[model samples]
Target: MIVRGVRGATTVKANQEKEILDATEGLMRTICEENEIDPENVAQVILTVTEDLTATFPAKALRRLAGWTHVPVMCAQEIPVPNGLEKCIRVMITLNTTKAQSEIHHVYLNEAVKLRPDLQLTKDS
Candidate 1:
């Protein structure tokens, strides 16, 4: 199997610990579901949050999921760009899979939909 990267991002409603964890979990779960990814197949997960969000580490959310305890996860602060999105959390999931790069779907939710309008998906779609 080849290694593939699945990207996703979402904006939280606020800089609260619960909001960060919930948003992170929601984004990660959607990415995994859309890509048919198994936690065991995930090699690593890198999570980043905007500088304005410092309430908690988003990686903590993943560890609470079943089968994700052993997965390697890291969290970092995104660069405080002058005009970048705020209260946004981004994720990159590296996993072993047979799917091609073109088959991987990147998810952007909430206000993060503006980040990559070309790849946007909707419940209706």
Candidate 2:
């Protein structure tokens, strides 16, 4: 199976540790569910938070998932671009899967939906 990347993003109301962790966990769960990803097949997870979100590293939340201990997870600060969304957390998961790239689901939650309206999850999704 070829490796595929699943992208997801969400925004937190504040920079608190709880808010960041909750939002990251929610986003990770949605991405796995939507894409039918197996945690064991996950090669790596890279998490990024916008400049305004400095309360904690988003990658810390992924540790709460089962079978993620061996997965290589990294966290970094997002580049401060003009007009960028604030208090946002993004995750890109690399996994081994047979699914085609077009069939992969990208999740965007909260205000992050504005970042990619085309990939927005609808009520029926």
Worst 10 residues of 2 by lDDT: 116-125
Write one digit per residue (lDDT tens) for candidate 2, span 5-63: 99988998998999999989888888888898889999999999999998888888888
- Best by the lDDT measure: 1
> Which residue pairs show collisions in model 1?
none
Q: What is the Cα-based lDDT of residue 73 in candidate 2? A: 95
- Candidate 1: stretches off by over 4 Å: 120-125
Model 1 TM-score is 0.94
Which portions of model 2 miss their true places by more than 4 Å? 120-125
Among all windows of ten consecutive residues in candidate 1, which has the lowest summed lDDT? 116-125
Clashes of each: 0, 0
What TM-score do all the candidates reach, one by one?
0.94, 0.94
| Model 1 superposed RMSD (Cα) | 1.9
